[model samples]
Target: MAKYSDEFKLMIVKEYLGGPLGYSLLSRKYGIPDGSIIKKWVNAYKAFGKEGLSKKRSKKVYTVQFKLNVLNFMKQTGASYQETAIEFQMNEPSLIAKWNITFIKEGIEGLKEKTKGRPSMSGKRKPKQSKQEKVISREEQLEHENELLRLENAYLKKLKAFQDNPNAYLEKHKQRWHLNSKKKDLN
Candidate 1:
C-alpha cells in the first residue's frame, strides 16, 4: 500500500487528463504502481476537480435518509455515479455507485449501514406468518399446481391428437393463425 501525496497525484492525474494515452501507458511511463490507481485518480479528478484526488478525510458515516435522497435524485435525473458524487459532495464517486447497487439489490432497507459480520439472533421476534395464513398459502399453492396439471394434461392431449392427424391439425392451425393475424392487422 503506497500513499501518494496530493501534489504527486495531481501531477499524474493532470498528465493523464491532458494526454490521450490512458492509465496503462501512464503506469508504464511513470512507474506509478498499478494502472488502476491512475484510472481511479483520473475519474476522481474528472468528477470533483482538485478536491477529489486529495487524501480522504476521516470516514464519515452517512445516514440512511441521506443515502435514499442521493439515490432518489440520481434516479430522477438519470445521473451517473460521477455526477451523483459531484452533486452530493462525496469524495469517491464509487460510494454513490455502491449505494445504488445496495438500493437495487436489497431495497431501502439495504441503505442502512449494518454491522459487518454475522448478524446476532438474540433479538426475540414474532413469527412472520400464523397457522391460518400458512394454511391459506398452502391451499393457494396446491390450487395453482392443480390448475397447471390440468392445463398440461389438456396440452398433451391436443399434442397427441395433432400427432395422430398431422394434416388435419396443420390445416386447422393455419386457419387459426390467419384469423389471429388478420385480427391483429385490423386492430
Candidate 2:
C-alpha cells in the first residue's frame, strides 16, 4: 500500500508549485520527515503531470537490456539516480540505485530478472560419501592441529604482554584510547 495517497501527493505538489514555500518549509508544514520527498513529487509532477503522482498498482518489470541502457545513460550523462529514473520514465529512482549497486557487485549477470517466491525443491538428492572419503588424512589433521596451536601460542603471548603492562601494550598497539589521547593533545 502507498504511504501517501495520490490526491495528497497532488495537493502537496500543487501547494509547492503555487506557493513561495520551498521543499523544506512545505515538508515541515506537512510534518514530513524528509524534504526530498516533496522535491521528488514536485519534479515528477513537472515532468509527468498528475499521473506521475499517482501510485502504480502493478510492478513494472524491465528487461536486462533496458537496465543496461539506463545504466549506460547514467554513466554517459553523469546524471543522478533520480534524473536517470525520470529519463527512463521509471517511478522508483531507488530501483536504478539498486541496479547500479548490483551491477557493481555482481556485474551484468546480476541485472537479469530473478525468479520470485520460494524456489522449487529438487527431487534428486546427493549420494552420501563413503566413510573413507569423509575421513581426513592423519598428516592433514596434524597440520590443522599445529596451525591451531600456533594461533593459541600467539594469543597467549599477546595476553601475557597485555597482563604485564597494559598501558605499554595499548600505547604500542595504538589502541582507541591512545589514539583519542593523541587527538586531544593535538586539539
Candidate 3:
C-alpha cells in the first residue's frame, strides 16, 4: 500500500540477506506487515540487484522485442509470471501475466502493444450521398410534357402582351422571375 524509497528497500534487503534469521523474525523485527514481500524483495535483489528492489514505476512502455524475449525465457525456463516479472523488474506482475496470455493466444505478433486511447473520428466518417432512383410511368411522362407545353404557351402569351405593353406582366411576376434567374446563376 505504501511506497518505500530505494535506499530503504535496499537496506532492508541487505539486512535480510546478511542475517540467518527467517523471514517471519526479520519481518517482526523490521515491522513489515508481510514477510512474503521481503522474500520477493530478496528474490528481486538476487535477480536484478538493487534495481528490482526499487519502488514501483508507472505503467511501463515495453517493446515488442522485449516482451518476446521475456516470453521466450519463461517458456525455456518454465518460470511463473511472478518470478519472471521480478526477474525482469517489470512494474507489475500482471503485466507479464497478460503478456503470456496474449502470447499464448496470438503468438509472437501479439506481444506488440496497440496504440492507446480513443481513436479519431475524421478518418472513419464519409460524406452523405443520395441513392434514390427515379421511375416515371409513360402516362406520367406524357402529362409532364403536356404541362411544360402549357407553360410555354403561357410564356408566349405573356411575351406578346409585354411586347404590346411593357406593364402587361405584374411587377410581382417580374420580381419572381428575376429572383429565379439569380438562383440559377448561383448554381
Best candidate (score: TM-score): 2
Per-candidate RMSD vs. true structure? 18.4, 19.0, 8.7
CA lDDT for candidate 2: 0.90
> Could you tell me the lDDT of residue 161 within candidate 2?
99
Q: Tell me the lDDT of model 1 at 72.
A: 93
For model 1, how many clashes? Answer: 0
Measured by lDDT, the strongest candidate is: 2
lDDT tens digits, residues 22-123, model 2? Answer: 999998998888899999898888878888888788988899999999999999999998899899887788899999999999999999999999967888
Single out the weakest 10-residue window by summed lDDT for candidate 2. 123-132
Candidate 2's C-alpha runs over 4 A off are 121-187
Superposed on all Cα atoms, model 1 deviates from the true structure by an RMSD in Å of 18.4
Cα lDDT of all candidates, in order?
Answer: 0.86, 0.90, 0.80
Expressed as tens digits, the lDDT of each residue in 1-187 for candidate 3 is 5666788778888888887887788788878888877777787788778878776556568899998888888899999877778667663566788888988899878887788889776776765554334677889889989999999999998888878778746775889999999999999
Ordered by lDDT, highest first, the candidates read: 2, 1, 3
Using all chains and alpha carbons, the TM-scores for the candidates as numbered come to 0.51, 0.63, 0.53
